[model samples]
Target: METSQALLIYNMASVEKCPETLTAVNASSKQLNCSIDTYGNNQYMCLPNAEKSSLVEFCYNGIMGIQVEGNCLEAKDGRVILHSCKKFLSGCPKKPFFNYDFYKYPACQHINLKHFCYESDPSCQALENSGGFNNVSNDNRDIMYGLIGGLLVLVILTIVIAGFINERRWKRWWWSFTGVGNEPDRKPDKTSGTTTNPGL
Candidate 1:
């Protein structure tokens, strides 16, 4: 699965076409650093007008979503382009770097500004196969570690149980580290009607 792709309608909210959608894009005025390509199903998904005459379109069954994130790059010309980054969109509204009213237009909250969704492309599967944005992010890596760590817990517990069984059979002197048999049971002497301990 692509690490990330153009969002589908389900992934986002309130769908509409913005011919002036370029207002939502931020190219950093720098050259596009990354050049990864994804294909929609039979047809392509959205192509970057900015990326020469490369015609990228979507081909997933119906219009699911898109992966490349862009906004109204051509919004100024009243023509819309979906190739903006809005890299700063996460910590929006609550702590906006540049204040813009997002409540009225939540999509306006896109820090990459140029963020938009599109129809699903079956051919886009090619892009999906090529891999997504980058190696698993640090947060995702942490989650992976956690899942692995959790699974390892079961292994640890199984080892512990096995150790207990072995300890019972062998009576090892070094089996105390796990605190498995820390307490010794006290038995009452019927004749003396008194209690005595073994470790003492």
Candidate 2:
């Protein structure tokens, strides 16, 4: 019997803390929307209705496909290999999880890790590999082009038809005003005993 390969997974954990490192903070409080300090850490002093400062900590963990030396985690070929054991940790609020200077260890500098992992999932990977999104985008582009082309053709046709109608109307008005087409030839004025030349 053949054994199946183990599928790698990514996981994230988060915790909120108050001024005291060991004390837990309420996540549902409206005052959590405080401003961050210059160092990118949350300013506990800005928390409204708060008696003390607070911070949030996030930890990441998972298994790496390959072994790495030292404390470095592998982020090769856009894959993150978690080297650290899954452990609950604390850190300053507003700081990123991968900031080595603030919260040490298991650090890899892949920005947007959550998005990368989501795309790497088997279902999403299949769609991407098969050009699902690409196909949709292409289809949308084609539809837009077709609509623009059709509108341009309609506008041109309208302009041509309008010009034709205006030209006919102008000809009719000019003929009526000048009496050019239906004028009768002048006849002799018998009562005055005078005859006018037809050419004149």
Best TM-score among the predictions, by candidate number: 2
- lDDT tens per residue, model 1, 1-200: 11322322111112232211323222210122212223322211222223222222222223323323333221111122343334323321222221111122233322221222211222333444455545578899899899999999999999999998876655434434554543234456578976566657
For residues 88-123, write the lDDT of model 2, one tens digit per residue: 121112222432222232122211222332222354
* Backbone atom clashes (below 3 Å) for every candidate: 48, 0
User: Once superposed on the true structure, which residue ranges of model 2 sit more than 4 Å away at CA?
Assistant: 1-136, 181-200
Superposed by TM-score, candidate 2 places the C-alpha of residue 126 at a distance from the truth, in angstroms, of 30
Model 1 worst lDDT window (10 residues)? 25-34
What shift in Å separates residue 187 of candidate 2 from its native position after superposition?
25
lDDT of 2: 0.35
Q: Each model's TM-score? A: 0.26, 0.29
